[model samples]
Target: MNQTRRKRRPDPSLSRLDSLSPEMLFPAKSPSLTSSRIRYIFLLLTFCFIIYIIFSYGTTFRREQISSIARSLSVFSTRRRHLLFSIAASHDSWLRRSSYVRLWYSPESTRAVVFLDRGGLESDLTLPPVIVSKDVSRFPYNFPGGLRSAIRVARVVKETVDLGDKDVRWFVFGDDDTVFFVDNLVTVLSKYDHRKWYYVGSNSEFYDQNVRYSFDMAFGGGGFAISASLAKVLAKVLDSCLMRYSHMYGSDSRIFSCVAELGVTLTHEPGFHQIDVRGNIFGLLCAHPLSPLVSLHHLDAVDPFFPKRNRTESVAHLIGAASFDSARILQQSVCYDSLNTVTVSVVWGYAVQVYEGNKLLPDLLTLQKTFSTWRRGSGVQSNYMFSTREYPRDPCGRPLVFFLDSVGSDGTEGTWSNYNLHRVGNCHRAEAVERLERVRVLSRKLKHDVEQMVAPRRQCCDISSPYNKSMVINIRQCMPDELIAMNT
Candidate 1:
């Protein structure tokens, strides 16, 4: 086996492989392909960083923007200087109706212009400046028994906007005879956003009138408001819109149609009173809605506000009371004295009703039918917009009445209003309430914020035991969980 062993030579292929360089085993790629791959990786990393940033800080940025907007809005609360009034009137009625305007108009503070059919009148410092309406002869009218002057009245909206008043927030429209509680008007308008479109007012009290015209229409006599933003747009398109609504009967109807064309509807406020009724309005004034009294219309059609005073004097009396505390005017408050079995309802700055037994608050809030219907008819025609209870024809069945005698401040944030007993029918009254000859109500001036105006709650009142032929009542905010009911 040893003699057979022999050495063999290496193969030619193996010797060639061992001699090759290191570059042959690992090769390099082109520069273009390598550069493209690097760029793709960089782009993906940058996109992920951007998405993380947005998720971390986007909500904070949005919150800061909203805060800035709210601060700007708070700086400009509505004031008397923010309103511009355009009163529609005629030369024939101006002399008589101007008196009504003077009652509420303040030469120094109120900004108003009376739009008359004709100009050329003696200048009076007591009245607002007068402007003759632009001729509206071109507009068409097809309604039977309707006046063409409605076109002129409707045009007042355009003419007022053209005046170019600076810093005006609201443009208010009213009839010459309409009486507005300006302070209360300002309070109500402050609750709305003037930057948006708004149409604020009320309809007629009579159901028939609403059916005859439109339940959605805001009666012009009651007065109405247009936000400055909406007024500008409405003024531009009113003429063309008037051409389309030529068949409408009243000026308010024309304005309503034009506003409707813009996709806006009436924003009803119960404070505006059309007073579409006849005879005494005692019941209406006594049971006013739980809101500030904004405006009153049709003073000539109804009896004087007070029993003995003339029409103008009666209105002046109410206005005098309003001058002290307009926000509380006509606000009704009910309370009961359980020990004496007596119930009393106080209409601040207006009147007072004293009942014998424990009367429910809901029953006292209903309107008493002391006045007749707006139209002479039966059934639906005589119906009213609100709930009403029949006023007793026999004086003996009625409660004791008291009318506002005077009102004044209490030298602080508080104020006092005095009411004198209005002697009526010689009816036998309950022992607890018969001797009451006067009522003195003590309250603080109402200053409501936006939240309170949005969701108003009825105030609570406490009555002091009757003393020396007089009674005292203190009105205050209700306590949490308090109920207005007779004590068990």
Candidate 2:
């Protein structure tokens, strides 16, 4: 019995050892360690995901913050301006490198900065602008130290795409050296609505008193609200005229050329001063205000010294002091919305179509230009050049004789004309075209012989060959002694 019991006990112990699973025992009871490893991997994934979320949130928050800040501050400026945005580099360093960012960050123009970011390469970015002013104007050259004003304007355009996107309708270009104060400008804007038309340029001295239909326009100082198309035309004029009129590329004449090329309805604002400062500021909105004194050519900076940087501030203070203080100005108003950029474009063509019964030396050109300009409380195309005249008389009333469009009987039909129907007899389109061309050449000769008779007394008296610019095709201003047609 003892032997049997001892054998059974050993058998039981052997069986217990054999009953354990090979995988369970081989791994060595490391359940806790396995659990710890899985938990660690899960924790690492969670941590990484959380970090990603936070970083993403931070980036989004920063953009929102910038947009929010811009929207908050631009509610009350006198001029509604656009600020375009763009990242010019792959990293933030290039943005920091530009002088624009420095000037943008400057306290003086701090309000002007909608964004300063690192946009990579040649791409453009336009941000929504804060309509800080009630009246809308554009401030493109916000920074100093750049030969490319167009680039600066491009940047500004990028910055101000979204603000007042639907209502933001105009652009006024002023320099940093001008008397520009955000608060006062805003005050002025709020009081008057400039979105009524496509363009409104500054005033120039208007001295011609004797010419028929001759506008006694004030000297247009330029740099005012123009249609997007007019602005484009001005740029094109600059490009083309720069090549043609190489000697006359100064800002002043170039500006005049731009105005002429657009054939925009030109009028002026006596308030838009060219220079505002001191005694200049005293009478005008600022010192040397354009109206106070058209332009201060007399300031010979004490033996030809360069103008100080403070000139901008000087102009700003002087202009700000008086222009912003008008009693008729409106109070600032607030709105709860973001300023986002809106895309804008302007397209324009030659002001007249001779085929439409318009005449060479066509006043119809001027009439078309004048009428095309979007008027206050009127519906019109933006590309129509605007005039700044207070009177409702022909806004774009300028003589348009597109002699260049003619090749003189090239298309034949003898330049068909109702005037010569009896003399030349019925002709085909080609013969009529040719006839019209012959008539054009003869009329031009006749006009050359009687230049003094056709043109106004002033222009005719001073120049020996003033008719060089004139190309009379049909009847003068195409009038059967009609007052409306004859006046121009």
Candidate 3:
């Protein structure tokens, strides 16, 4: 009883968290500190909730910034590739391995011959890197003298093949963007009995000096195929004439010039179109010959990495698109950075458009991209502008929204017409995106092809392209009395 009396009297008025019992420590309501404690707890909880809200929003905002940064970095990587090559000053054994170079065809054996513009051969080849390190200025053909550029390329093709690379029966002025329908081409070509009358798409048309050369048989606009004998004949003609007129602007004109010099007639076939520009119907694949024709000169979407159809998807619902029965060929250029000559990496053209209820309505008329611009530095750069049909944009905001592109290059026109606004917004908001779901799925697929190109080097000498496995008969064997008019 004496010990119990001493422990009870310590602190009944004093409030301590540790001193409190099970019920008294945190009672639902108590006379001492109950009201004040409830108010303090409410304030503390409100502050914590505010902090959590701020942290959550801040985390979301940071994630968006990081995503935007990644996109920007990817875009910037393309621009910096030249810079990387510039800094890397080594022509090591790796580059010289020949395996590093794709299309491992023995230049001697392969039928493909490239004829690029050759104005800068001498100046360019003498540099540290025999090939261009950056955007070649007056490059491609850097051989001495202004030699129509194509000749230099032809010579390289000839020399490479001559050096025991591969056996070539036919010669094609193959373009970069053109993807061959090898199966159809070889099959159709095998069936042909006469080579005298060359076969091009029977429905092709050509225009020269305001005179339209519409053919019932075929039209040859871009690259065309020729027998080795025809190639020799053309080579001889170029040998006789190129030294005399090396400064001519048009390479295609040079082809006509060679024909004119040799007095050789050209036969046309739908298969030998510039590519996606024109073709015919009936006894072939797709009968619908589009506004853009096809041949050696191919018109693919913008980038192989991101193929977006530059023009209107469908001509339906347009006010006057039905009038576009016949195709019109216009030589357009997109000047990325120039004044005198437009830099056309991809083949394309500009079409004017008007939007009507989510439809990208296009005008049938062909418009050209003017290679001219307002000056920024010392040099007057080419203005990258396309002619518009009826562009209704803000007069002060963006001025005009136009689609512009070039020929034989991946014809990626710059216009928001093809863009599905809601779809793009969804892309921006999506947590994760699939490439196949985007507008440029084809482009992504094409870009992926670059990996295949740069992958394992094929042996040039043994390189028979399985990609174009056709009637790979010897040129001499194919040469009967009727084919290519060769008696031998």
Highest lDDT against the true fold, candidate: 1
Give the clash count for model 1: 0
Q: What are the per-residue Cα lDDT tens digits for candidate 2 across 460-480?
A: 101111122231322122233
Q: Give the TM-score of candidate 2.
A: 0.27
Candidate 1 local lDDT, 302-339, one digit each (tens): 99977689999999999999898888888998988988
Per-residue lDDT, model 3, residue 356, is: 15
Q: What is the C-alpha lDDT of each candidate?
A: 0.89, 0.29, 0.29
Give the lowest summed-lDDT range of ten residues in model 2: 342-351
- Candidate 3, superposed: residue stretches over 4 Å from native: 1-148, 154-169, 187-222, 268-488
Model 1 segments more than 4 A misplaced = 1-71, 74-76, 377-380, 466-468
Which regions of candidate 2 are displaced past 4 Å? 1-168, 181-199, 203-223, 232-238, 276-488
